[model samples]
Target: MGVFRIGFFNIFIYLCCAFLYSVPNVCGHNNMCFDCIDLEGCKAPKHFLKYMSAVDRDKVVLRLPTDKPDPMMDRCLNTGYTIKATLNGTVCSGSSDGLCHAIGEATTNFTITYSHCGDCYIACDCYSQENGNARKEGPIILTMCLAAFYTLIQ
Candidate 1:
């Protein structure tokens, strides 16, 4: 009976380790949004005002922790870029080298992961372009026209 109990404990430990390592890193994920700091007040360029659409808070699963210090800075080179993340319902922002972690209770630093560990946000600057991000659900007429134009040229 004792031997069986010991084996079960070992199996539980193995399963826990496997689950912990399976989480995806958030910063490296391929999601982007408007570059503007103020979503409600920022206006898109008029070039294709038709191409513009309201920011979808629905898709903003991760609240960019812009109000706090960035936690992803590369300590080795002392070089980092500003980024955002959320911890325990509070927004935290700080310098990061394209990666970050959430500092929680008792000095527990949890690695930022996609959808599970903490909320991660990506703004326009993260993708290196102007506010070029537009919703696929934007004006279908304009989107269809653009698609048609590309097809004809190709």
Candidate 2:
């Protein structure tokens, strides 16, 4: 009876661990949300915006039309560029060109990077124009404690 109870608990714990680890990656890559901070208020002449919300592993890419004339080109050109990310309206990371990662308590991290640029005028706008890609690998399992916790709870 004791061995059977132990086995059942172990199974339960294992399932719970799996569930928690895999939940963050489920918010599909192609999902788009407009009016994001990186897109809505960005005044750059030409900028590529990409964000990975803590709830999702895939980067959300925002593409804006270049046909419209922008008055902010002067500021954009002068400043060169800027990149920003936020969660719940709070700034998480900001940089001119580099990788920034913000780890939250929600079991995920938000990372943003800006790269490759030339003259910054609206007409001369240059950026690293590339399609964003997201790849998912199986959940990380690095602990016997986690496995035991997973199995015991089951």
Candidate 3:
């Protein structure tokens, strides 16, 4: 019983450390990334591009990612358009114009006139590729550590 309890506690600590190490520092300017757009009553990447095409038809060209979007990609659809981040142990959600606010988590049923990510021509996906990898290697390291730890306990 004692050995089992010790092993469980060790696993819990390992999980906490792994999680903390995985969080990115989130420094620099709060980057502008597409959270989605409202078009024809739909909030999606395709809609965002369509709306932009009409708004800046002569000035800019828009396209989807060449490769499939990474599952780890942060931007997605939600009600009222939201942004989320992590704190000590709590997950925080807020609007694009504000900090991690207390507006609560987003839902599929939310609505918004626009997400306010249209200030740049470079697109959010490009920005993600440039800076989103801050914690990319952290997951790989955590996995390796867990595998080694499992072997030790076995």
Candidate 4:
């Protein structure tokens, strides 16, 4: 009985790993290369967050990388950040205007200065089916799978 149980667990682990590998993720890189919008320097390329304060209001500091500008990029959903820098374990504090905000799903879309990105902008709301809310799916899937596996083991 014990040997059969051990074999079952081993087979289960192998299947789980295979399933994970079957899913491809664009998160292994540091940037998201969208046709309209662009971002770079995300410490967690896979878990690029769209909104954080919603998840944690009073979260004045967000752990994210800065933005990389493109010449053809024409709109701003959330723009005009007073300051922008890589949060490489560094903390930042400041006031944000009506336009400046930490809102999104995967990676943070923040403005740097008034020159390129100004205040009072909108339309950062478009999401592709392939890339939209899928940013939040990986962790959720893994968590659920692990939970189920734990229960099975028990």
TM-score of each: 0.23, 0.25, 0.24, 0.19
Error of 2 at 136 (Å): 44
**Cα lDDT, all candidates:** 0.31, 0.30, 0.34, 0.32
For 15-42, candidate 4 gives per-residue lDDT tens digits of 9998786442322222121212221111
Off by over 4 Å in 1: 24-70, 73-154
Where model 3 places Cα greater than 4 Å from the true spot, the runs are 1-53, 59-118, 121-126
Q: Candidate 3: how many backbone clashes?
A: 1
Candidate achieving the largest TM-score: 2
TM-score of candidate 3 against the unseen true structure: 0.24
Root-mean-square deviation of Cα positions for candidate 4 versus the true structure, in angstroms: 25.6
lDDT tens digits by residue: candidate 2, 15-40: 99998866544532111122122222
Clashing pairs in 1: 65-85, 68-93, 69-93, 69-94, 70-93, 70-94, 70-95, 72-96, 73-96
Global local distance difference test of model 2: 0.30
| Count: clashes, candidate 2 | 11
Residue 85 in model 4: shift from native, Å? 18
For lDDT, candidate 1 versus 2, the one ahead is 1
